[model samples]
Target: MLHAVIMAGGTGTRFWPASRAASPKQLLPLVGKSTMIRQTYERLEGLVPPEQTLIVTNQQLVEPIAEQIPELPVSQLVGEPCKRDTAPCIGLAALLVSRKDPDATMLVMPADHVIRSRNHFQSAVKQAVEMVGKSQAEIVTFGIKPTYPAEIFGYIHRGAAIDTRGDSAPSYVVKHFREKPNASTAAEYVSSGDYFWNSGIFIWKAKTILDALAAQQPEMLEHLKKIVDAWGTDKQDEVLEKEFTAIEGISIDYAVMEHAKNVAVIVAPYDWDDLGSWLSLARLLGTDRDENTIVGKHLGMNTKGTIIRSTDDHLVVTLGLKDCLVVHTPDATLVANKNDEESIRNIVKLLEQRGMTEYL
Candidate 1:
């Protein structure tokens, strides 16, 4: 059987004020009518039922996530005591799903991405499942065709094409993985046309990932095993808080995928967006005639290429501002240049350093 594991533990610090510590971007209804996590789960309707789905998030967010995704039983919502990045997160989920069915194929994805065309997304998943079914050792991941030079996302350098059974979608043997590159390197990669933005979406058999972790990351796997052993015990929380936070925080790419021999990339046939930062709002929600993406009450005189998000009660007025980002929450309002989106993380750090965590 196939299982869906949604990784929803991220704090989304870049989208601060609205995306706070307790309620992150995945919990918010940033994209559409439903929350981002709900949108992600709906994309797996026919492919994987709610019963087989699992959501891994921060312990504090467990109840909030349960409210939005009521279809999944509360038990299926796994809460991590602390942030250990994706490696430990996925490793834990793999063990839990594998316990039910040793032959389980798990579809792991983030909760904060905006992906249209569920059919196409599910189709790619099905194709990856097929690819995995044929050879369970082959770890399958999706590669979104980069429309531009993106400095934010990691890049996947795809190698020679692989046999996709019948070539439903383009499949390739994995070559190399590049971390977030500089603007010049990103442009060079884009010009080469062999790179795709690492979608961070992966599909593999439970045994496959566990085995890979055992090989490439034995020490971390041992700690994860201890956590798994304490899964149902009274000391579950105590051990998770201790072991998970102590584990080396690294992504799956560094922990396994980059070194795994049998890896493949399937060029996704769906429209995918990570919605990583505040600038992403302008991309997801288009701009008006003034080229400003306004979410709520906003009256701009010459705010072009600016992203404004406010509430119904507050009306933010901007004049003579271009390529700026203005987000108005009842508690905090963000005003910064859109081009300096990366500095949002610094602002969050500053807030944390100032001990003004009330705004975080």
Candidate 2:
């Protein structure tokens, strides 16, 4: 059997006022009418039922996420007391799943990403789950063939091909996991057909991952075990808050998968995007002849290769603006050169520094 865990704890600082502390990007509808998390959950419609799926998000977002994904019982929406990254989140999820079904295959993914072709995505997921089911110890992850040299995403090196299922996508033993590279390095990685942009979607057995966590992240695993022990008790919230915050914050790649043996990668069949920033809308919403992508009311005289987001009531007009990002919100508006997209994080930090809590 398979269980799903959706990691939706990200603050999404890059999205600014639209994606504030109360409502993050996952809760907001970025790609389509539905929220990102809702889209992700819907993508798993026939594959994994709501009863077998859970969401791990911020403690403050529990109510919002529950509201958006009402099919999931509030108990299944596990909220972290603080930010502890993916390792502890997955570890705790695996522990809880293993307690129910030790042989369960776990499908873990971020709630903010977009994956089209629901059938193809489900097929790929089934292939991954089947592969992991065979070995039980194999940690399987999906890898997207990079369209361009992406400096932002981690890369995975593929080894010899492993699984074959009636002309399905190839699965390979992952050779190495590489960090985000520089422009030159990224170009080199793209040139070499052996590397893939790590998609962050993973499938593995609950017990196997728990064992890996125990071996590689023992202290973290102990904390997770203690938290799980107190899951249904009166001390559930208190124990989770104390132990989870104390547990070290580390990515699954850094803490376990990078060191674990029998790790495999499945070249994904469906289109994918992480939607890291407002700039991502260019890829999703597409652009005009001038290469300007607009989601709402925008009138640009000379705007080319820019991304604009504004509602009907708040029309954004730009003159002589080329390759810029304009996001209009009721309280705060963001205007920046699209080339400096990474600096969006700086704006969030600056707001915090200036004690502008309302904007954050």
Candidate 3:
């Protein structure tokens, strides 16, 4: 059988007042009618049953997640005491699900990504599951076909092709993973035609991943093993709290996949976006012919290539502005040049430095 683990524990500070500690981006209806997390699981309906899906999130978000996706069983939703990153989260999910079905193929996905083509996305996942089922490979990640020279995203070099004979015909082996590059380097990657955007979506056998973890991230694997050994028993709470508290924070990319030689990449053709910042949302949503983007209630005069979003009932009026972003929430309003959207992280850093607790 197949199991999907949705990682949903991100703080989502880049979104600022719209995304806060109490309501992160995953739970907010920024993309469409439904929250990103709900849309993520909803897309996997016929491919994977509700019982087979697992949600790994923070302890604070457990109830909120439950309220959003009530179809998921209480036991299937795993929570970490703190944000220890994807390494521990994967280790925890691998341990829990492997116990139920050792041969289960796991599809690890972020809860906040937007995949436009739902049918194509599901077909790709089914193909990935079939591929992992037949091979000794421990892990596989989906690589999105690059549409632009995006410096904000990491790049993956594709190797030999995989037979994804679907309509999209996505192909690649992911020869190597590259960090986020400068504009010039990103342009080079775009011209080379061998680079794909790292989608951060992964699939693998639960037991096979555990074996890889034992080889690469041995110490972290041992820490997670203690909790797995106690699951379904009265000692689960005590062991989970003690072991997870002591575990170091690390991403699965650094701790496992980067070091594992048996890793593979499955090229996929789906309009995808991580929505890391408001700028990304603006581009994805696009603008009118006049180059004006408005969400919520807003009035614009002589504004071109500008994005205005407001959650409050108050009307936002922009005059003679071009290539800018204006976001108004109940608490804070953000005004920046459209080109400077990625630097909003600096604003977050400054808030942290100034000890502004309420804003974050």
Candidate 4:
């Protein structure tokens, strides 16, 4: 059996005003009529059934998530007591799936990503699952072929090929995972042609990942074991609340993937985007003939190469602006230069320092 684990705990502060703590970007209709999470779930239709799908999210988002994804059972929706990053999140999901079927394969992915070629995405996922089953690879990650030198995404260096008999999709040993680099470093990585953008989608057997966790992240494994033991009992929620917060806050990349020697990468044969910031959204929804991307009614005199989005029913007017980002909501609005999209995190912190909880 194969199960899907969707990680949807991110706050998405970069898309502030539109993405709030209660309703994150995953629950918003950013790209189309369906929400991001809904699209993610739908993409896994034939790959994994709803009964086998698990969603790990924050406690505050449980209700909205449940509402948005009613097909998933309430039991399958596990909420972390606190935000402990991807390591704990993946560990917890692994435990839950192991309880159901220890030998089951788990496909871990984020909810807020865009994949244009659904057929290719599914084909790549099938290849990854087969690679894990047939080869010695215990952990398989999907790596997107880099189109350009992008500094925002992490890089995956490919090593020697792992031959899978008669399988067309090539799999390679992960040489290493590198953090986001400078412009020059990114350029060099692209020119080398041996690197791929770390897509963060992973596949592994439930028991295999658990064994790896025992070796690399023993403490986290032990905590997860305690929770798994208490699951379905009267003390389930009680134990989760007490133990989840005690676990260290770290990412799976730091705690497991980077250290695991049995990791492999499968080149993703599809168009993908993490949608990390407003600029990414603009990139997806390109400019009109006037060199502007407007999601709502807008009257512009001299605006070129800008993105303007508003939720309320009002006309947004701009004059003599070029290459800017304007996001308007009922409560608050953000007007910034597109180059400063990465600084949205800083703006979020500033909001916190100024005690603006309502906006957050």
* Candidate 4 weakest ten by summed lDDT: 162-171
For candidate 3, the lDDT comes to 0.85
Q: Tens digits of per-residue lDDT for model 2 on 1-360?
A: 899999999999989868999998999988889999999999899998887898999899999888887888887889899998899999999988888888788999999998999999999999888887778338889999999999989999999988486678988889999999999999999999999999999998888888888889999998988999999999999999899989979999899877888888989999999999887899888899999999888788977888889887777888888999888889998989988988989999999999998999
Clashing pairs in 4: none
lDDT of 3 by residue, 99-213 (tens): 8888888999999998998988898787777677767345678887788899889988888876655563565666788888999999999899898888999999898779878
Sequence-dependent TM-score of model 2:
0.98
Instruction: Pick the winner on lDDT between candidates 1 and 3.
Output: 1
Tell me the spans in candidate 4 whose CA falls farther than 4 Å from its real position: 164-167
The whole-model lDDT of each prediction reads: 0.89, 0.90, 0.85, 0.89
List the candidates' TM-scores in order. 0.96, 0.98, 0.94, 0.96
Clashing pairs in 2: none
> Cα miss at 90, model 2 (Å)?
0.3
Residue-wise C-alpha lDDT for candidate 1, range 1-360, written one tens digit per residue: 999999999989889879999888998888887989889989999899887999999899999888887889987999888788899899999988888889999999999999989989988999999889988337888998988899999999989988655648898888888999999999999999999999999999999899989998898888988988988899988998888878988889889877888788999998889999988887888878888898989888967988888877888998999988888888898888888878888989999999998998
Q: Hey, what RMSD does candidate 4 come out at?
A: 1.5
The candidate that wins on lDDT is 2
lDDT of 1 at 96: 86
Q: Could you tell me which 10 consecutive residues in candidate 2 have the lowest summed lDDT? A: 129-138
Candidate 1 Cα lDDT to native? 0.89
lDDT of 4 by residue, 161-221 (tens): 9886574567799999999999999999999999999999999998877787788889988
